[model samples]
Target chain A: MNQQNILFTNNTAQAIDTAINNIRPNGIFVLTDKNTAVDVWPQVKAESTMMSEATLITINPGDTNKDLKSATLIWENLINGGATRHSAMICLGGGMITDIGGFTASTFKRGIKFINMPTTLLSAVDAAVGGKTGINFNGLKNEIGVFSPASHVIISTRFFNTLQKRELLSGYAEMLKHGLIDSAATFHKLIDSDPLEIDAGHMLELLKASVEIKRRIVNDDPYEQGIRRALNLGHTAGHALESLAMKKGKPVPHGYAVAWGCIIELILSHTHCGFPTNTLRNAAQYIFSHYGTPDINCSDYQDLLEFMHHDKKNISSECINFTMLSNVGRINIDRTATESEIKTALDIFRDLAGA
Target chain B: MNQQNILFTNNTAQAIDTAINNIRPNGIFVLTDKNTAVDVWPQVKAESTMMSEATLITINPGDTNKDLKSATLIWENLINGGATRHSAMICLGGGMITDIGGFTASTFKRGIKFINMPTTLLSAVDAAVGGKTGINFNGLKNEIGVFSPASHVIISTRFFNTLQKRELLSGYAEMLKHGLIDSAATFHKLIDSDPLEIDAGHMLELLKASVEIKRRIVNDDPYEQGIRRALNLGHTAGHALESLAMKKGKPVPHGYAVAWGCIIELILSHTHCGFPTNTLRNAAQYIFSHYGTPDINCSDYQDLLEFMHHDKKNISSECINFTMLSNVGRINIDRTATESEIKTALDIFRDLAGA
Candidate 1:
C-alpha cells in the first residue's frame, strides 16, 4: 500500500463510490465547464448521489478560461457554499478544468482536498493524476501555477468514448512518450493495442499502468528540480509550436504539435548531438508513419524561437532545449541549443510539411 | 560574513545600491498600485536610478484586487517584458502589493527573486520582510497564497513621512503587538511615543525590531506548520473586519482592522483561555483610548464567524482563533472558542459601542 492513502481509480462510478465511502465529506464542490456540466457532470452526480449542499460551478472551458477570473468565481462559489479547508473539490472535466480547479483548491484557504475526475483522454492519461496546477497569462501558457498534490484522482473511461479520435491520439502521444523515455515493453504494448478499441475489460489495467509509470517518475523527482526535466522531452519545441498555433488563433491540439516537435528535434540530435543516424531516421519514420507530419517552414522559424523563450524549463539567461539521443530510453536535458541549431531543426519540420 | 548576503536596510537609497551592485541584471520590474504608483514609486525610483529597461505596472490598490486576476496581469507583464528567472521583481508599496508581487514572482516560472520595498507603515515593519506570498480567493482573504522567502527586503522609513496620521496610528497598533507578544521593552517604547510626533530615526529602530521579531518567528517556522500560529494573534477577527470593510468599499485599512480585532480577541481570551483580566484591560484600554473603536456589532458578527471558517490555520473542522495571555511578553495560539463564547465576545464589542 502506498504511504499516501491516495487511491488511483479509473472507473468513474466506482471511483466516486470509493471516494464517498472512504472520505464521507460534509459537502462536495463539483468543478466543470459548460461542456462537462451539460455532458459529464450529470453522470458524476447520478453515480455519487451527492447531497443538495453539494455545489456545482460551471465555467467556460479551454485554456483561455483557465485564468484568474475563473479561479475567483470558483473561490466565490466554494466559499459561499460554506466550503471549508476540510471541504473537497472534485474536478470533473478536461485538462483546462483540472488545471483551474486544482489551482483553486490549492490556494483557496491555503490548500484544500481536490480530486481530478478527468473527462477527456488528454486529462485521464496525462494531466488528471499530476499535481501541477496553473493558468496562462501574458501570451505565455501556464506562466503562473503551483505544485499541489491532489487528494485522489479518478480516471473514468466513460468519458473516453466521447473523445474525438484526434483527442484520443493526442493523449496517446504522451503514453508513447512514456514508452520512449522509460519502458520498451510499454511501448510495444501500445503499438500492439488498438487504443480505438480499448475495451471495458482492459480499461482499468491500462490506466493503472500509465499512472504507475508517471508515479515512479514523480516519486523520483516530485519538485521538477532535476530528473523531472527529462519528462519535458518533446515539450520545449512542442510548447513553442502550440503557442505559435494559439497566437494564430488556430492552435493545434498539444499532442500533434509535440509529435511534430519530437520528429524535428530527433533529426537535429542525429546530426548535431552525435546520435546514430539510422536510429534517428527510424524513429522519425515511425512517428511520421504513425501520426503524419507537422506543418512548419523557414518563414515562421523565428516565431517558434520566440515561443521557446517563454518555456518554463529555460531557467538560465539563454533559451535551452531538452534534446534526446538516438538510443531508445535515453534523454539529454537542459542542453543549451543555439538559435541557429533550432532553426536547422525547424528546417526538418519544413521539409516534413513540403515547405 | 553571515550566510544571509543581504541585510534589511533602513535607508531606501543604500538598499537600492546594495541590490544594484549585488544582482546586476537585464531590467527591474517594479510592482505598485495606482495609489503607490502615484506617490510611493516616484520616491523609490528617485532613490535608485533604475536602468532604462526598468518597467512599472500600476494596479488598483486594494485587497479585492489581490486575487487571481491581479496575479495573472502581473505574470503577463513580466513575460511580455522578457523577465526571465534571473530578472528580479522589486515590490514597492504596501502589504497588498508585496503579497501579490511576491506571489507573482515566486510562481512566475516556478519562482524568481523578489525584493520588498514597503511604503506603508504596516508593510514596512511586517509585510516587506517575510516571503509570504499569496492572493485572496472567493470571499476568503489570503486564502490562495504560498510561503516563499524573498531574495531581500528594504525598509524605507521615508515613505511613512507621506502617510496620513490615521494610517500611522493604525500601524502603531502592530508595533504595539510586537511588544505585547514578545518584548516588554518594545511595548513600553510604543506606549511612550506619540504617533503624531514620531521621527524617522526613532521609527527605523522600531521597524528594525519588528522585522527582526518576524524574521525569527518565520525562520523558526517558515511554513506555519507549527509555532508561527502565534503570529496570527489578532488576525482571526482582523480578517473578518477587513472583509466586511471591503464589501462596503471604503475599507478600513488592514492595520486598523487588525488593531480592533486584537482588542476583541484579548477581551475574550481573559474569560476562557486563562488570560489575566488586568492584561486584557490594559491592552484594550491602551488601544481603544488611542485608536478610538471601529464598529463591530451583532448584525455583522455572523459574517465574521463565517470568515473565520476560511482561516488558513484551521487544521480540522473547527474554526480556531489565536488568543494571547495577559503576560507582557508571551502568546498562546490556535485556541478554539465555542460558538456561544464568540457570541459573548461580539456582545462585549456591542456593549462597548453602546450600539
Candidate 2:
C-alpha cells in the first residue's frame, strides 16, 4: 500500500484519468516545467476531463532550476492553491519536474499523494520510478532530498514521441544498462536497433521493460540500505562527470554520463569479477557510438575523482563504491574499488572511447 | 520493519552503549546543541565506550536554532566529517537537536541509521518519537520536513533531571495531554502531582507512558492518513501560540503552550463534542494556575487566528482543524470547526484563563 503503482497506457489522458479516479483526492495540482507547459500541458487541457479542473503550476526548465528556491516557490504555490493531505499533485515533465514536484509534494504538510507523469523517456525509465526525490542544494547535485515514492507512475508514449534525438539517446543508454544488468536478449536487441529511428510503440515497450528492472530493485529496498545500491551501477563515475560538466557550464544529460560510466564499470567488472571481455567491449562500443564522450581531458580526471570521493554510495572509508555485473542479470552490488584501481579504469575508458 | 525501536534505560551511558552495539555502525556521529554539549556530552564521553569515539557535532541550542540554517550547518559538518551510509548518528539534546538531527541523518546519503538520545523530557515524550523530523523553513514552523524515524529512541533521565523548571513543565504538559487522550488514570495522577516535585524515576515512567501513546498512534498510521491525527490533540492552537511567542522575541516553551492550548481545545471539545464541563474547567484551572497565559489580548486573537489557519492538519477548504474529545479517552479526530467557532473558543479560553 505504501509503494507506487505503475500505470501503463497507450494514451496519456486515459492514464491520468485512471490515476485521478483511483486516488479520489479532495484537490489536485499538476506541476510542470516551461518546456512541458507549452508542449504537453495543452494536450492534457484539451484531452482530459479529470485534469481540466486541476491547478497547473509551471517552473523553469532544466536541472539548474531544481534548487531550494524553486522548491520554496512550489511550496508557496501549493499553499496558495490550498493543497492538503487529502489533496494529490501530478508531477509532469521530465526528471526535473518529477524530482522537484515529488520533493515539494512529499514535504507539503508532511507529504500528500503524488502521481508522476514522466514525459521524457529518461524520466520514465529512471527518476519517475524510484521516488528518489530531491533538489540541488548549495551547488551540489541532488544534495537535499528524501526517499518518498509517488502513489502512481503514469507512463505513456504521447509525450515521449516528441523528444529530441539527444534526449532519446540519453534514455536509450539507460535501457542498454537495464539490458546488460537484466535481460541479455533485451541488451542485444537494444545494441542492434538505432535509438533515433525506433517507433514510439516499440520504444515505449522497451522503456516499460527497462524501468521494471529498477522498480523491482527499488521495491525490495526503497531506502537503499542494502541491495538497492545495484541501481547505482554506473552512477559513481557518471555523477562525477555530470557534475563537472555542469560546473563548466557545458552540461551532459544524466543517462549519457551514466552510459559512459557503464563502460568503465564493466571494465572493472571484467578485472575484479571476471566478467566476459567480449560483453564488456560490446557495451562500451555501443555507448561510445551513441552517447558520445563527456567533454573531459586529463585535467578534468582529478576533479572527476574528487567528485567520486563524495559519491553517496561510499562507506565510511576512503573507497569508491561500485556496482558491476559478472554477467547479464548477475548484479554484484556493495563492492568497492581503490582510488588507484578506479583511476586505472578511467585511463582505459578514455583510451578505448577516444575521449 | 521501518519502525523505530525504543530503549528504556535508567543509566544514560548504558543506553548510548546499547544503541551503538545494536547499530554496529562503521562510524558514529553524535549531534548535540549548546545546552547538551556542555551538560550531557561530557557524560557521554566520560562514561560511554561507544560514544567517546563518536564525532561530536554541536549547534546553537533552543527552538530558534531549529531552522534551515542550523540544518545546513549540520549537513556540512556531516560531510566534512566523512559520514557515510554505514555511519550512525546519535542525536543528543531536546526536541531541537533530535528533530534537526533526525532530518539531516535521513537525508545524508539518502538516509543513514540514526539513534535519538532525547535529553529533555519534552523531546522524550513528543519530538523524539513518532518519526516527525523537521526544521522550520520559510518563516513557518516545521514547514520543511519528512516522516523518517530513527533506528532507536534511547530514553534516559540523566539530563532531564537537570532541566530548568519551565523545561520540565513543558514536558509534563504533554504528559497531561497523553493522560487526557489515552489514559485517564495517568492524566489524574499528573494533575494531582506537584509537577516541579516529581522524582526522576516517576517522571521517567510518566514520560515513557506518554511517548508510548504517541508511538502507538504513529505506528498505526505513520503518515497521518487516518488515526495518527489523534496525536495532534492540542498542537493546533498550541503551535500557533508558540510561534507567536517566538515572533515576539519572548518565546514560550512548547509544552506550556500545549498546556494552555489543551484548555482552549478542551473548551472547544465541550462546545462541539459534548466533552464534560467539569473536566474542561478543571483542566483550564490547572493550566491557568501552572502554565500561565500566552501574554496576549483581544488584539492578538487575529494573529493567533492567522497562525491557527496555517496549522498542518487542516484540509483544503477554509476551516480550522480540531482534534477534540467527547470525553477523556474518547477522541474525535478529522474534525473541522468554523472560524467563528474557533474565535468563540479563543474568547472563552481568555475568559476562563484570564489571559
- Each model's lDDT comes to 0.73, 0.84
Clashing pairs in 2: none
Instruction: Write one digit per residue (lDDT tens) for candidate 2, span B1-355.
Output: 3788898877878777777788888889999988789887897789977777889899998878898688889888888887766789999899999888988887776678899988888898889988888888755688767788899998877787679999988988888888898967877888999789988888778778888888888888987878877777888989988988988889999999998888888988999899999998888888888887778777788888778877777764578898899999899997888878888988898888773
lDDT (10s digit) by residue, model 1, range A1-355: 1112345454567766677566666568888999888886666677655623468988998777887678778888877777766688888888898888888787776667777778877787777765778877666777777777666777656677777878887877777677666756776677677666778558667766777777777777776766766677678888898888888888788887777777666666666667666655555665666666655556778898888876877655465657575455666766667788778777765665553
How far residue A29's Cα lies from its native spot in candidate 2, in Å, is 2.0
Residue A298: error of model 2 in Å?
3.0
Report the C-alpha lDDT of model 2 over A254-347, residue by residue, as the tens digit: 8899998888888888888988988888888778888877777777878888788777777745778899888877899977888788888888
Q: In candidate 1, which residue pairs get closer than 3 Å at backbone N, Cα or C atoms, i.e. clash?
A: A107-B144, A138-B76, B134-B145
TM-score of chain A of each: 0.91, 0.97
lDDT digits (tens) for residues B262-340 of candidate 1: 8778766776666677666666777777777776656877777777666766544554556565566667666778667
Q: Chain B in candidate 2 has what TM-score?
A: 0.97
